[model samples]
Target chain A: MRRLKALIKKEFHQIVRDPSSVMIAFILPLILLFLFGYGVSLDANRIDIGIVMQDNSPQVQSLIRAFENTSFLNAQVERDRREIEKQLVAGKLRGMVVIPTDFTRRLINPDDTAKLQVIADGSEPNTANFVQNYIRQTWVNWLLQSGLSEAMLTVDERVSIQPRFWFNPELESSHFLLSGSIAIIMTLIGTLLTSLVISREWERGTMEAMMATPVNIIEIILGKLIPYFVLGMSSMVICTIISIVVFGVPFRGSFITLAAVSAIFLITALQQGLLISTVAKNQFLASQMAFISGFLPAFILSGFVFEIKSMPAFVQAITYIVPAKYFVSCLQTLFLAGDIYSVIIPNVIGIMILGSVLFIVITRKTRKRLI
Target chain B: MLNRIKNLVIKEFLAIWRDKKSRVILIVPPMLQLFIFSFAATLEVKNVPIAVFNRDTGRESWELVQRFEGSPYFTDIHYIYSDKAVKEYINSQKALMVIQINDDFSSRINSGQQAEIQLILDGRKTNVSQILAGYVNGIIDRYNRDIKPEAQVRRSSQNAIRKGKLTASPFLSPASRSEIVPRNWFNENLDYIWFTVPGIVGILTMLISLIITSLSVAREREFGTFDQLLVSPLESTEILIGKTVPAFIIGMLEGTFFIIAGIVFFNLPHEGSFLHLYFGMSVFLLAIIGIGLLISSVSKTQQQAILGAFAFMTPTIILSGYATPIENMPLWLQEFTVINPLKHFLIIIKGVLLKNVPFDVVLEHTIPIAVFAVISLSVSTRMFKQRLE
Candidate 1:
C-alpha cells in the first residue's frame, strides 16, 4: 500500500510538472468547447439571391418586394443578366430570380403563365435545395396575398400532416454537437495523453528502471490509470459546464448516470492508449497509432459527424467496435433527453464490456519485464 | 551556404527513410484517409426507414405508399396498424419518420373534400428530418397534381389532339401555372463526391505537412540532437530549409496523390490550368509548414508539438469551409478566418478545379495565401533563430 501510494504521488508529480499534459487536460476543453459551440453550424439562412427584373410594373415590383421581406433571403437587384451570372459563378450569389420581361403582361391577362425562373448554384446541393424551397415558399405567399390562388386556397382538399419533432423541437444542432464534442474531447484527453506519457517513459529508459523495482504490473497500471482517470473526469466536468452554461445545451439526464457512463468511457479510452504504448514502445509510433486509432475513428465512425445508419453495411459493422459510438449515444441522450433507461442501459453496458476487455488485454500486455 | 543546405536536406531525407515503418506510415495513412473519408464523409441521406400507418385501403392511398417505396431515399417502409405502433417505432429509432394516413384520405379525394395525413419525424437528427420533410412534400405535391381536375381535363384534350380528333384550342386557360425552372451551375447533378475531392486535397495537404514538420525539430530536441545540428557549421536558415523542404516535398507528394485519386477514381473536374493549381498548392504548403515549424521551435518535446498542432488543426479545418461554408459562420468568426491559409487554399483549389476560373481569378485567391505564407515563414525563421541563441 505504501509503495502504491508513492507511485500514485509520483504519477501526479509527473502530470503536474509536465505543462503539456496539464494544458491538454484543462485548456484543450476550453478551445474545443468554444470551437464546437460557435464555429460549426449546419443551418443555411440569409441566402444571397440576385434578382434580375426586366419589367418595372407594380405587380412585378411587389413580387420582388415580397422576396426581400423574407428573413431567409437577401435580394440584390442587378440590371444586367451577365453581371448576375458572374456573381452566381463566383459564389457571391447563391441563386438568381429572373422576373421575365412579360411577367406583368402575363399576370394581368391571366391567359399566359407568368414564369419566374429560379437558377441555383448547384455546386453545393444542400444550399441549392434550401434556396429553391425558400423562393417557392415566398412565391406561394405572394400568390395568396395577390388573390390569384383564391380558388386553389378554397379547395383545401388534401392530407394534413402534422410533423412533431420529438427530442429536439427546434432542431438546434448545437445541443447534440456539444454533447458529441464531449465524447471527442474526452477521447483525446484520455488516449493521447496516456499514450504519450507511457511511451515517453519507454523512450527515456525509465520504464526499464521501474521494472527492476518491487513494483508489480498491476500497481504500475493503477498508478498510471488513476491520475488520468481524474484528469479525464475533470475535462468531462468542464465540458459539461461549458455545454450547459455557455452553449445553452440542456442537461436533461441525471448527473449520476452521466458520471458513471463517462467513467466507463474514460477507462476504455485510457486502456486503449496503454495497449498502444505497450505494443509500440516508441513515443512517435505510439502517438501516431493513438491518433489513427483514437482520433479518426472517434471523429468519423462514432456517429458524431456522420450517421452510422447512413453508412454502408460493412462500415456500419465497423462502427460497433468504436467505443466512442456507445458514448456518443449515451452522452447525446443524457444531454438532450432525460434518463431513458433503454438507451442509457444498453450503451453503458457496451462501454463497460469494451472497457473490461481492454483492461484485461492491457493487464496481460503489462508484464514485469520491459518490452 | 547552398551546398550546406543541400547536404542537410539529404540528411533529413535519410533520417526518415532509414525507418521502414515510418516510411510506410508516411505513404499509407494519407491514401487510406483519402478513400475512407471520401466515402464516409457524405451529406447524402439514403435508405431512411419510415413507418406508414395507412388506414385508408383506397387506390390513391396505396399509390401514395407506393411512391415512397419507389424512391431511392426511402426504404424499409414498415406498415404499422395503430398510432401506438408508430410511436414505439419512432421512440426506439427503428423508424426515423411515421406517415399516418387518415381513414378518409381516398374518400375525401373522391368527393373533392379535404383530407389530412400526419408525418411524425424524430427531430433529434434535424438535418435528416428537414431533408425527409422536403422529400415527403414533393411526393404529396405530385400526388395532388395527378388528381387535379384541371390537369385531368388538359390531359383528355391533349389525348384528343394527339389522335387528330380536334384542332388546337383557340381559348387559352386563365389558370395556367407559372413554372420555376431551376438550373444548377458548375455542378449540374450536385454530386457530393465532386464537391468533396478538391476540399479534401487542401485539407489532407495541410494536415500531412503540419504533422511532419511540427514533429521534425521537436523530435530532435526531445532526443537532444537539436544541439548537435545547432553546433554544426549549418546556419539557422540552412537548418530551417533542411527541415521544411522534406515536409514540403511530402505535402506536395500527398497533394499529387489526392489529385490523381480525385481525377481517376472520383472524376474530379480539372477546369483550370494545372500550373496554377500546383503553384497555389506549393504556397499553401509553405504557410502550413511555417505554422508547423513555429510549433516545433516553441515546444521542447514532440508531444507538445503534436498537441499544439492538434489545437491549431481543429479550428482551421472546421473554419476552412471544407465541411461547412465560411459565410454561414458568424460575422466575427468569418472575419477571423481571413488569416486562415487553409480557407484561402480551399477557395483557390475548389474554384480552379470546378469553376473553369481564369488565372486572374485564381490569383486573386492566391494573393492572400502568399501573404500568409510569407508572414508565417518569416515569423517562424525568427523564432528558430531566437531558439538557437
Candidate 2:
C-alpha cells in the first residue's frame, strides 16, 4: 500500500512537470469546446441562392418578394439563366430559382399551369435538400397569402400540421452538439493521457529500472491509472462547466450520475490506451494507434453529428463497439431529456462490459519483468 | 549531394516499412476507415423509429398511417393508445416523434373541415428531428393534395382581377396553379455516398501524412538519434527533404487508392480529368506535410508531436466544410477557413469529381494551397536551420 502511494505521487509529479500533459488535460479541451460550440454548425442557415427573374410582371414580383423575406435564403437576382447556372456550377450558389416569362400569362389563364424551375447543386445533398424545401415553403406561403388558394377550396378543407419540437423548441443544434462534444473531449483526454504513459517509460528505458524496484506491476498500473483518471475526470468537469455556463446548455441530470458515467467511460478509454502502450511499447506507435483507433472512431461512429440509425447495417453494428456511442447517448439524454434511466441504464451497462474486457486484456498484456 | 539525399530518403522509407507494427498501421487502418467513413459517416436520415397516437377510427387516418409506413424515411412505427404512452416513447428515446390525431380527425376531413394533427418531435436530436419534420410535412401535404383535388387550382386570377388585368372567373382548372419543378444537377438522385467519399479521401490523406511527417523529427529527438543525424554528412535541407518525401509519397499513394476505391466500390463518378485531381492532391500533400513538419520541429517529444498533430487535426477537419457546408458558418468563421488547406482541397476535389471543373478553376483553388505550402515550408525550414545552428 505504501509503495502504491509513492508510485502514485511520482505519477502525479510527472504529470505536473510535463507541459504537454497539462495542455492535453486542460488547454486542448477548451479549444475543442469553443470550436465545436461556435465554429461548426449543422444548421443550414443563410444559404446563398440565385433568383433569375425572366418575368418582370407584378405578380411574379410578389413571389420574388416572398423569397427575399425569408431569413434562410440570401437571394441574388440575375437577368439570365445562363449566368445563374454558371454560379451554381462554380459552387458559388447552392440553388437557383428561374421565373419563366410566361408565369404571369399562366396565372391569368386557367388552362396552363405555371412552373417555377428550381435547380440545386446536388454535390452537397443536405444543402440541396434544404434549398428545395425552403423554396417550396416560400412558394406555398406566397400562394396562401395572395388569396390564390382560397379560389380553389375553403380553408377548412386543408389539414394543418402543428409541429411541436419537444425538449428543444427552437431546434438549436448547438445544444445537442455541445453535449455530444463532451464525449469526444473525454475520449481525447482519456486515451491520449494514458497512451503515452506506459510506452513513454519503455521508450525512455525507465520501465526496466522501475521493474527492478520493490513495487509490483499492479502497483505501477494502479499508480499510473489513478492520477490520469483524476486528470480525465477534472477535464470532464471543466468541459461540463463550459458547456453549461458559457454555452448555456441545460444540464438536467444529476451531477452524481454525470460523474459516475464519465468515470466508467474514462476507465474504458484509459484501459484501451494502456493496452496499446503495453503491446506496442513505443510512444510513437502507441500514439498513432490511439489516434486511429480511438479519436477518429469516436468522432465518426459515435453518432455525435451523424445519426447512427441512418448508417448502413454493418456500420450500425460496428457502432455498438465504439464506447463513445454509449457516452453520447447518455450525454444527450442527461443534458436535454434529463435522467431517464431507461436510456441511461442500458448505455452504462454497455460501457461497463467494454471496460471490463479492456481491463482483462490489459492485465494479460502486462508482465512483471521487462521483455 | 543528390546521392546523399537519395540515401536519406531510402533510409526514411525503410525505417517506416521495416517495422511490422508501422507496416500494419500504415495500410490496414486507412482501408478500414475508408469503408467505415464511406458507409457510416452519412447525413442522410433513414429508418427512423417513431410512434403514432391515433384516436380517430376513420379510413383517412389509417391511410395517413399507411403512407408513413410506406415511407423509406421511417421503418419502425409504434402504435400508441394513450397520450402517456407518447410521453414514455419520446422520453425513453424509443421514438424520435409521435404523430397525434384527435378523435375528430377523420370526421372533420370527411366533412371538408380543416383538421389539425400535432407532431411531437424529440428536439434533442436537432438535425434528425428537423428532417423528420420535413418528411412528415411532405406526407401530409401530399395527402391534402390527393384528398382535395379542387384545392390545387390557383386563385391568382383574383389577384389579376384586383389589378384590373382580367375579369373575375369563378372556376379555373387545376393547371393554372404555380408549382416548383426542382432539378438537382450534378447528382440527379443526390447520392450521399458520392458526396462523402471524396471528402473522406481528403481527411484520411491529411491524417496519415500529418502523422508520418509530424512524428519524423520528434521520434528521432525522443530516441536521441536527431543528434547523430546532425553530426552526419547530410545538410539540414537534405534531412528535411528526406522527411518530406516519404510522407508525400505515402499521402499520394493513399489518395490514389481511396479515389480508385471510391470509383470502383462506391461507383463515384469521375467527371473531370485525373490530371487535375493528381495536381490538386500533390499541392494538398505539400501543404499538409509543411504543417506536419512545422509541428514536428516545434515539439520536443513524440508525445508533444502527437498532441500537436491532434490539436491541428481536429479543428482542420471541423473547419474544412467536410461534414457541413462552409457557407452555413458565421462570416468571420468562414473567413477564418481560408487558412485551412483541406477547405481549398475539398473544393478542388469535389469540383473535379462532381462538376467537371475547368483547369483554371482548379488552379484558382490550388493557389491557396500553394501559398499555404510555401509559407509553412519556409517557416519550418527557417526553424530547422535555427535548430541546426
Candidate 3:
C-alpha cells in the first residue's frame, strides 16, 4: 500500500512538473469546446438562393414571398439568368427559383398547367437537396391555399399526418455534438497522457532505475494510471461544464451516471494507451501509435461526426471494436434523453466489456524487467 | 561545403530508412488512414433505418410502401404490427423514423379525398431526421404527381373528376400544375468519395510534414544527439537543410502518390493544370515544414512535439473546410481560418480537382499559402538558430 502511494505521489509530481500535461489537460479542452461549439456546424441555415421571376403576377410575387419568409433561405433577385449560373459555379448562389412568364396565364385557364423551374447547384448535393425540398414545400402550400380550382364531387375531408418529435424538438445539432465532443476529448487526454508517461520514463532512462526498485509491475501500472485517470476525469469535468454552461447543451442525465460511464470508458482508453507505450518504448512511436489507435478511431468510428448505420456494412462491423462508439452513444443519450435505462445499460455493458478486455491485455503486455 | 550538406541529408535519410519500423511509420500509416478515413469520414447520409406501420390495406398504400422500399436512401425498414412495436423500435434506436399510414388511407383516396400519412422521426439524431424527412417528402411528392397526368386534362369538371378519381384535387387545377425542374450542376450524382478523396491529399500531406519535421529535432534532443550535431563542423544552414529537406521530399512524394491514386483508382477528376497542382503542393509543404521545425525547436521532448502537432491539427482540421463548409461557420471563425494553411490548401486542391478552375483561380488561393510559407520559413529558421545556440 505504501509503495503504491509513494509511486502515485511520484506520478502526480511528474504530471505537475510537466507543462505539456498541464497544457493538454486544461488548454486543450477549452480549445476543443470553442472549436466544436462555435466553429463546427451542420445546420444548413441562411442558404443563398437566387430568384428569377420573369413574370410580374401577384401570385408569383406571393410564391416568392414564401421563400423569403423562411429562416433557412436568403432569397435574392437576379435580373439576368446568365449571371445566376456564374454565381452558382462560383459557390455564391445555392439554388435558383425561376417563375415563368406564363405562370398567371396558366393559373387563369383550367386546362393549362404552369411550370416552375428550380435549378440547384448540385456541386454540393446537401444544400441542393435542402433548397429543392423547401421550395417544393412552399409551392405546394401556396397551391393548397390559392383556392383557384373549382370543387369536385365527393367529401373534402382527408387524412393528415401530425409529426411529433420525442426529444430535442427543435433538432438542434449542437446539443448532441457537444455531448459527443466529451468522448473525443477524453480519448485524446487519456491516450496522450498515458503514452507519454511510460515512454517518457524510457526516454529519460528512469525506467531502469524504477525497475531496479522493489515494486512490482501492477504497482507501477496502477501508479501510472491513477494520476492520468484523475487527469482524464478532470478533463471530462471541464468539458462537461463547458458543454452545459458555455454551449448551453442541457445535461439531462444524472451526474453520477455520467461519471460512472466515463470512468469505464477512460479505463479502456488508458489501457489502450499503456499497451501502445509498452509495445513501443520510444516516445515517437508511442505518440504515433496513440494517435493512430486513439484519436482517429474515437473521432471517425465513434459515430460522433458520422452516423454508423449510414456507413457501409463492413465499416459498420468495424465500428463495433471502437470503444468510443459505446461512450458516444451513452453520452448522447444521457445528454439528450435523460438516462433512459435501455440505452445507458447496454452502452455501459459494452464499455465495461471493452475495458476489461483492454485491462487484461495491458497487464499481459506490461513487464518489470528492462531489456 | 555542398558535399558536407549532402552528407548531413544522407545521414538523416539513413536514420529513417535503415530502421524498418521508421520506414513503415513514414510510408504505410498515411496510405492506410487515407483508405480507411476516405471511406469512413462522410457527411452523406445513406441507408437510414425506418419502420413502417401500415394500418391501411389499399393498393395506393402498398404502392407507397413499395416506393419507400425501392429507394436506396432508406434501408432496414421494419414493419411494426402494433403501437407497442413502434415505441420499442424507437426507444431501442432500431428506427430513425416511423412511417404510419392511417386506416382510412385507401378509403379517402378512393373516394376523391386526400389521405394523410404520419412521419414520426426520432429526433435525437437531428441531422438524420431532417434529411430523412426531406427524403420521405420527396418520395410522397413524386407519388402525388404520378397520380395526376398532364396528357389527360379536360375543361369539363365532371369528366375530369370521373377520369381522375384519385388524381383530381379540389384545389389543384390541371392547367396550373407547376413542375419544379431541379438540376444539380458539377456533381450530378453527388458522390461524396469524389469530394473527400481530394481533401485526403491535403490532409495526408500536412500530417507527413508536421509529424516528420516536428520529430526530427525533437528526436535528436531526446536521444542527446542534438548537441553532437551542433558541435560538428556542419554549418547552421546545413543543419536546417538536414532537418527540412528529407521530410519535405517525403511529404511531397506521399502527396503526389495520393493524388495519383485518387485520380487513377478513385476516378477523381483532375481538371486544373498539373503545374499549378505541384506548385500549390510545394508551397503547402513549405508552410507545414516551417511549422514543424518551429514545434521541434520549442519542444524539449518528442512527446511535447507530438502533442503540439496534435494541438495544431485539431484547429487546422476544424478551420480547414475539409469536413464542413467554411461558409457555414460564423463570420469570426471564417476570418480566423485565413491564417490556416490547411484551409488554403484544401481550397486549392478541391477547386482544382473538382471545379476545373483556371490558373488565375488557382493562383488566388495559392498566393495566401505562399505568404504563409514565407512567414513560417523565416520564423522557423530563426527559431532553429536560437535553439542551436
Candidate 4:
C-alpha cells in the first residue's frame, strides 16, 4: 500500500508537471465546448427573407402577419422574384416568398385555391426547406380562417399536420450539450492520460525499472490509474460546473446517481486506456489505439450524434460497446430532467455492467505481463 | 559532395522502407483515416428523436400519434402516458420533441372548431431542434388546414362553442417555417461537411506522419543505432534530409488516400487544379515533418520524442478548424494558427475540394505553408548540428 501510494504520487506529479496533460485535460475541452456552444448552432434565427406580395390586401396583410409571428424570419420586400434571386448574390437573403395576386380573392370564393411562391436559397437546403414550409403554413392558416368551408377540403388542405413537441419545453440546445461535454471530457482525459502514462513508461524503459522493483504488476497498474482517475473526476466536475453554473443549464438528476454512473464510466475509460497501452507498449501506438478506440467511439457511437434508435440495426448493435452512450443518457437525464428514474436505472446498471467487463479485460491484460 | 549526399539519402530511405510494420504504419492508417473521415464528417443533423404523448385515448388522438410516428422528420419511439409524462420525457431528454393532443381535440375538430396541440421540443441541440421544430410546425399547420372549412361558412355557429385556452380561433393562425427565409447561419451553403472533412484530413496527416517523424531519431537512439549514423561523414543537413523525405512521403501518401476517398465516397469536388493541391500539400507536409524533426533533435529517448510531439498536438489541433471554426477563436489564437501548417492546409484543401475556388485564392494560405516549411526546416537542420556538439 505504501509503494502504491508513492507510485500514485509520482503519477500525479508526472501529470501535473507535464504541461500537455493540463492543456488536453482541461483547456482543450473548455475551448471546444465554448466554440461549439456559440458557433456550431443548428437553430436559425434573425433570418432575412425577401418577399413579394403581388396583392396588397388586408387578407394578404393577415397572411403576412403570420410571417411576422415566427421569430425565425422577418421579410424584406424585393422588387420581384428575380430581385430576390439577385439579393441572394448580394448576400441579402437566404430565401424569398411570393404572394400571388389572387391570394386574398381565392379564400373569399368557395372553390378558388391560392398559391404561394417560395424561392429558397438552395445553398442551405435544410434551413431553406424550413423557411418555405413556414410560409406555406401561414398561408394555409389564413385560408382556414377567412370564412372557407370547415371541410372545404382543397387537395393541399385535406391531409394537414399538427405537431406537438414533448419533454424539452423550450428546446434549449445548451442543456443537452453541456451534459454531454462532461462525458467527452472525462473519456478524453481518462483514456488519454492512462495511455500516456503506461506507454511513456514502456517507451522510456521505466516499466522495466518499476518491474525490477518489488512492486507487482497490479500495483503498477492501479497506481498509474488512481491519479488519472482523480484527475478525470475533477475534469468532469469542472465541466459540469461550467455547463450547469456558467452556462446556466439546469441540473435535474440526483447527485448520487451522477456520482455512481460517472464512477463507472471513468473506471472503464481508464482501464481501456491501460489495456491499450499494455498491447501497444509504445507511446505512439498507445495514443493511436486510445484515440481510435476511445475518442472516435465517444463521438460517433455514443448517443451524441445520430440517435441509436434511428441508426441501422447493426450500428445500434455496435454502439453497445461504446461506454459514452450510457453516459450521455445519464448525463442528459441528470442535467435536464431532475429525477428520471425510468431512464436512469437502466443506464446506470448498463454502465456498471460494461465497466465490470472492461475491468476484467484490463486485469487479464495485466495478469501475466509486467514488462 | 552530391554523391555523398545521395548515398546518405538512399540509405535512410532503405532503413525506413525495410521495416514491415513501420512501412505499414506509415502507409495504412492514412488510408483508413481518409475512409473514416469521409463517412463521419457530416455536420447536418440526420435523424432526431422526439417524444409522442397522447391524452385523448381515442381514435383521433391515435391517428394524430400515427402521423407523427410515421413521419420521417421525427423518430417517434417510446410513447409517454400523459402531459406530465411528456414533460418528464423532455426533461429527461429521452425525447427531443413532444406532440400532445388535449382531451377535447377530436371533439373540438368535429364540432367545427380547431384545437391547438402543444409541441414541446427538447432544445438541447439548438440548430437541430430549431430545424426539427420547423418540420413539426409545418406538419401540424397542415393538420389544422384539413378541418378548416368545417368551421368557416357552414359551421360558424358551432365554432362559437370553441374553448378559450386550447381553442384555435379564426384570427389566430400560428405561423410556422412554412415561409422562405435566409440560409447559412454559420457557413453559407458551402455544405458543412466540405468544411469539416478538409480539417479532419489535415489532422489525419498531422497525426500519422508527425508520430513517425517524432520517433524516428529517438527510436534509433533508444535501440542504440543512432551512433552509427552519427559517426558517418554525413553532415547534419544530410541527416536531416535522410529523415525528412520519408516523413514527407508518408504525409503526402496519406493525403492521396483522402483525395481518392473524397472522390469515390463523398463525391467531393475539386475546383482548382490538382497540381496546386499537390504543391500546397507538399509544402504543408514539409513544415509539419520539419516540426517532427525539430522534436527528434532534442528528444533523447523514445518517450520524450512521443510526449514532445503530443504536447504540441492538442494545441495544434485546437488551433486548426476541426472542432471549432477558426473565425470564432480569439485573435491571439488566430495568430497562433498562422504558424500551424494544418490551419493553412485545411483552408487550401477546402478551397480546392469544396468551393472549387481558384488557385489564386488558395495561394493566400499556400504561401504560409511554404514559409513555415522553409523556416522550420532551416531551424531544425541548424539545431541538428548543435545537438551533435
Candidate 5:
C-alpha cells in the first residue's frame, strides 16, 4: 500500500512537472467542448432559399411573406427559373418555392385548384427535403386560414397543433453538441494520452529499467496512473465549464453526477489505452490503434454523426461495447433535461460495467508483463 | 540527375522492404483508417420514426398518411392520439416530428379550404428538423393533390405553359412529354452515401497513412538509427525516397480497396474512366507523401512530429469541403484551400463518382494537385541532408 501511494505520487509529479501536459490537461478539453457546442450543429438555421413568385395577389403576397419571416428560411429572389437552378447547383439555395399564376383566384374558385411548386436540389437530400417541406407547410397554413380552401367553406373542422419541444425548449444546439463533445474529448484524450505515455516508456527502454527496480509493479503502474487520473478530472472540469459558461450550454443536471460518471469513463478509457500501449510498444502503431478503437468509435458509433435509434438493429447492438454511447446519453440528460434519475441510472450502470471489465483486463495485462 | 533520382528511388524501396516494421507501417494505417472511418464519417440521417395524429380520418388525410408511409426516409409511423402523446414522443426522442392533424382537416378539404398539420420537432438534434418539415410539406402537397379539382386543372394548363411563357405550339405538343422525363445521369436516387463514401475514403486513408509515416520516421531519428543512415553511404534522395514510397503504396492500395468496396457494397455505380482516376490519384498521392516527408524532416522527434501532423491534418480536413462546403468559407480561407492537395483530389473524385463528368472538365482541379505534388517533392528532397542539423 505504501509503495502504491509512492507510485501514485511519482505519477502526480510527472504530470505537474510537465508544463505542456498541464496546459493540455487544463485547456484542451474546455476548448474542444466549446467548439463542439457552438460549431458542430446539425440543425441548420437561417437557410438560404430562392423564390420566384409569378402571382401578384394578396394571397400570394401573404404566403410569400410567411416564408420570408420563417426562421429556417433566408428568402432570396432569382430573376428566372434558370437562375434559381444555377444558384441551387452552386449551393446558394437549398431549395426554391415557386408560386404559380392565378394562385389566389384558383384557390377561391369552386373548381380552381391552388398550387405551390417546390423544386429541390437532391444533391444534399437532407437539407433540400427540409426546405421543400417547411415552405409548403407554411403555404398550406396560409391557404387554410385565408378562407381559400373549398373544404373549409363546407365543413366546421379545425385542428389545433400545439407544438411542444422536449428536452430542449429553446432549441439550443449547444445542449446536444456539448454533451457529445465531452464523450469525444474524453475518448480522444483519455485513450490517446495514456497510450503514448506507456508506449514511450517501452520504446525508450524505461519499462525494462522500471521493472528491474525493487519497487512493486502495481506501485510503478499506480504512480504512472495517478497523474493521468488528476489530469483527466481537470480536463472534464474544463470541458464542463467551457460548455456551460463559454458556449452557453445548459447544465440542468447535478455536477456531482456528471463527475461520478466521468470518473468511471476516464478509468475505462485510460485502461483501454494502457492495454493497447503495453501490447504495441510503438508510438505510431499505438496512436493508430488508439485512433481506430477510441476516437473513431467516440466520433461515429457514440451517436455523434448519426442517430443510433435510426441505425439498423445489428449496428445498434454493436454500440453496446462503446462506453461513449452511455456517456453521451448521460451528458444530454445533464445538459438538456437536467438530471432525470430514470434516464441516468441505466447509463451509470452501463459505464461502471465497462470500467470494471476494462480495469480487470488492463490489470491482468500489466501483471503479465511484470511477471 | 534523372539517373541519380532513379537509383535513390530504388535504394529507398530496398531499404523499406528490409524492415518488417516499415512494411507493417505501410499496410496497417490506411486499412485501419478506411475500416474505421467508413463506419464513422456519415452525414445522412437514416430511419426517422414519425408519429402521425390523424384527426381528419377522411380520404385526403388517409392519402397524406399514405405518402409518409411510402417514403423509405421514414422508418416507422406510429398513430399518436393526443397532444400529450406528442409531448411524450419528443421528450423520449422516440420521434423527431409529430405530424398533428387539426380536428377540422376533412371538413376544410371538402370546402376547398387549406388544412394545416403542425410539425412539433424535438429540435434537440437540429440537423434533422428541417428534413422532417420537408417531408410533412410533401405529404400535404399530396393531400392537396388528391382533394383539389383546381390542382388537376392547373396541371393541364401547365402542360400548355413552358418556362412561365405560353407559346402557341398546338401543332407539336408531342415534345412536352420528354420534358417530364429527367433520367438522372450518375445516381438516379442520388443516395447521400454515394456522394460521401469515395471522398471520405480518400481523406481518411490519407490522414492515417501520412500521419503514421511522418511520426515513424521522426521516431527513428529521435531514437537514433538516423546516425546510422548518415554513415551508411545512402544518398539524400535515396533516403527520402526510401521513407516515402512504402507509405505511398500503402495509401494507394487502401484507397483502391475502398473504391472497389464503394462500388460493390454501397451500390455506387462508377461512370468515370479507371485510367483517369489512377492518373489523378497518383498525382494526389505524391503530393500528400511529400507533405508527410516535409513534416518528418522539420520535426524534432516522434511526439512533436505527430502533434504537428495533427495540426496540419485538422485544418486540411476542415478546409477540404468535407464537413462544411469550402465555397461558404471566407475569401481568405477559401484562397488558403487552393494550396491543399486534398481539396483538389476530393473535387476530382466527387466529379468522377458523383457527377460522372468528362475528365477534361475536372482537369482544372486535377492540375493543382499535380502542381502541389511537384512543389512538396522538390522542397522535401532539397531539404534532405545526411545529418540532423
Candidate 6:
C-alpha cells in the first residue's frame, strides 16, 4: 500500500512537471470547447441567396421584400439570371431564386400557372435543402399576408402543426454540441495521457529500472491508472463547469451521477491507453495508435456530431464497440434530458464491460521481463 | 548541395520505411479511416425511429401514419396507445420523434375544421430534430394539399383577386398556383458520399502530413540526436528540405490514392480538371507541411509534438467548412478561416470534382494557400535555424 502511494505520488509529480500533459488536459480542451461552442455550428443561418428579379412588376417587389425580411436569408437582388448563376457555380450563393418574366402575368391571369424558379448549389445538400425550405416558407407567408389565400378558405380549415422540441426548446446546436464535446475531450485526455506512459518508460529505458524495484506489476498499473484517472476526472469536471456556467448549457443531472459515470469512462479510456502503450512500446507508435483508435472514433462514430443511426448498418454495428458512444449517450441525457436511469444504466454497463475487457488485456500484455 | 539534400531525403524515407510498424501505420489506418469515416460522417438523416399516438382511429389519421411509414427517412414506427408511452419512447431515445393525432383530428378534418397534430421531437439532437420536423411538415403539407386540391385552387384565385393585383376576368381558371421549381445544379442526386469522400481527401492528407512532419524533428530532439544532426555537413535548409520532401511525397500519395478511391470505389463524378486538382493539392500540402514543421520546431518532445499537432488539427478541421458550412459561422471566424489551408483545398477539390470549376477560380483559391505556404515555411525555417544555432 505504501509503495502504491509512492508510485501514485511520482506519477502526479511527473504530470505537474510536464507542461504538455497539463496543456492537453486544460488548454487543449479550452480551445476545442471554444471552437465547438462558437465556431462550429450545424445551424444554417444567414444563408447567402441571390434573388434574380427577371420581372420588374410591383407584385414581384413585395415577394422580394418578404425574402429580405427573414433573418434566415441574406438576399442579394440582381437583374440578370446568368450573372447570379455564375455566382452559384462559383459557390458564392447557396441558391438563386429567379422570378421569371411571366411571373406577374401568370399571377394576374388565372389561366396560367406561375412558377418561381429556385436553383440551388447541390454540392452541399444541407444548404440546398435549407434554401428550398426557406424559399417555400417565404412564398407561403407572402401568399397568406398578401390576402391572396384569404378568399379561398378560412385559417381554421388548414391543418396546424405544433412542433414541440422537448428538452432543448430553442434548438441551439451549441447546447448539444458542447455537451457531446465533453465525451470527446475526456476520450483524448484519457487515452493520449496514458498511451505514452508505459511507452515513454520503455523508450527511455526506465521500464527495466522500474521493474527491478520492489513494486509489482499490478502496483505499477494502479499507480499509472490512479493519477491519470484523477487528472481526466478533474478535466471532465472543468469541461462540465465551462459547459454549464460559460456556455449556459443546462446541467440537470446530479453532480454525483456525473462523476460516477465519468469515472467509469475514464477508467475505460485509461485502460485502453495502457493496453496500447504496453503493446506498442514506442511513444510515436503509441500516440499515433491512440489518436487513430481513440480520438477519431470518438469524434465520428460516437454520434457527437453525426447521427449513428443514419450511418450504414455495418458502420452502426462498429459503433457498438466505441466507448465514447455510450458516454455521449449518457452525456446528452444527463445534460439535456436529466437523470433517466433507463438511458444511463445500460450505457454505464457498456462502459464497465469494455473497461473490464481492457483491464484484462493490459494485465495479460504486461510482463516483468524485457523482450 | 543537391546531392546532400537528396541523401538526407532518402535517409528520412529509409528511417520511416525501415520500421515495419511505422510503414503499416502510415498506410493502413488511413485507408481504414477513409472507409469508416466516409460512411460514418454523414449529416443526412435516415432510418429515424419514431412513435405514433393515434387517438382519432380515423381513416385520415391512418393515412397520415401510412405516409410516415412510406417515407425512406423513417424506418421504425412504434404505435402507442397512451400518452405516457410517447414520453417513455423519447426519453429512452428509442424514438427520435412522436406523432400525436388528437381525438378530434379526423372529425375536425372531415368537418372542414382546422385540426391540430403535435410532433414531439427529442431536442437533444438539435439538428436532426429540426430536420425531422421539416420532413414531418412536408408530409403534413402534402396530405393537406392532396386531401384539399380544390381548396388549394380556390385559395390561389381568391388570393390574387383579393389583392387586386390582377384584373378580374370572367374566364378565371384554377391554374394560377405559383410553384417553386428547384434544381440542384452540380450534384443532381446530392449523394452524401460525394460530399464526404472529397472532404476526406483533404482531411487524410492533412492528418498524414501533419503527423509525419510534426513528429520528425521532435523525435530526433527527444532521442538526443538533434546535436548529431546539427554537427552534420548538411545545412539547416537542406535538413528542412529533407524533412519536407518525405512528408510531402507521402501526403501527395495518400491524397492521390483517396482521390482515385473516391472516383472508383464511391463512383464520385470527376467533373473538373485533374491539372487544377493536382495544382491545388500541391499548394495545400506545402501549407500543411509548413505548419507541421512549425509545430515540430517548437515542440521539445514527441508527446508535445503530438499534442501540438492535435491543437492545430482540431480547430483546422472544425473551421475548414468540412463537416459544416463556413458561412454559418460567425463573421470573425469566417474571416479567420481564410488562412486555413484545408478550407481553400476543400473548395478547390469539391469545385473541381463536382462543379467543373474554371482554372481561374482554381487559381483564385490556390493563391491564398500559396501565400500561407510561403509565410509558414519561412517562419518555421527561421525557427529551425534559431533552434540549431
Question: Which whole-number lDDT from 0 to 100 does residue B156 have in model 4?
Answer: 42
TM-score of 5: 0.78
Deviation in Å, model 5, residue B277 alpha carbon: 3.2
Identify the leading candidate in terms of DockQ: 6
List the TM values for chain B, per candidate: 0.92, 0.95, 0.90, 0.78, 0.79, 0.94
Ranking by lDDT: 6, 2, 1, 3, 5, 4
Ranking by TM-score: 6, 2, 1, 3, 5, 4
- i-RMS for every candidate: 4.9, 2.7, 4.6, 8.4, 7.7, 2.5
Q: Provide DockQ values for all models, in the order shown.
A: 0.44, 0.64, 0.47, 0.19, 0.18, 0.65
- How well does each candidate superpose onto the true structure, as a TM-score? 0.93, 0.96, 0.90, 0.75, 0.78, 0.96
Higher-TM-score candidate of 4 and 6: 6
lDDT tens digits, residues A1-371, model 1?
Answer: 88888998999998888899988999988998888777777777599999998888988888889999999999999778988888787777889999889888876654567888889877776687788899988987787676555434433345555777777888888788778889989889888999999988898999888889999877888888898999899989988998898888988899999998999899999999888888877777777778777887887788776777777777778778889999998888788777877778888888888888887777666743444
Give chain A TM for each model in order: 0.93, 0.96, 0.90, 0.82, 0.87, 0.96
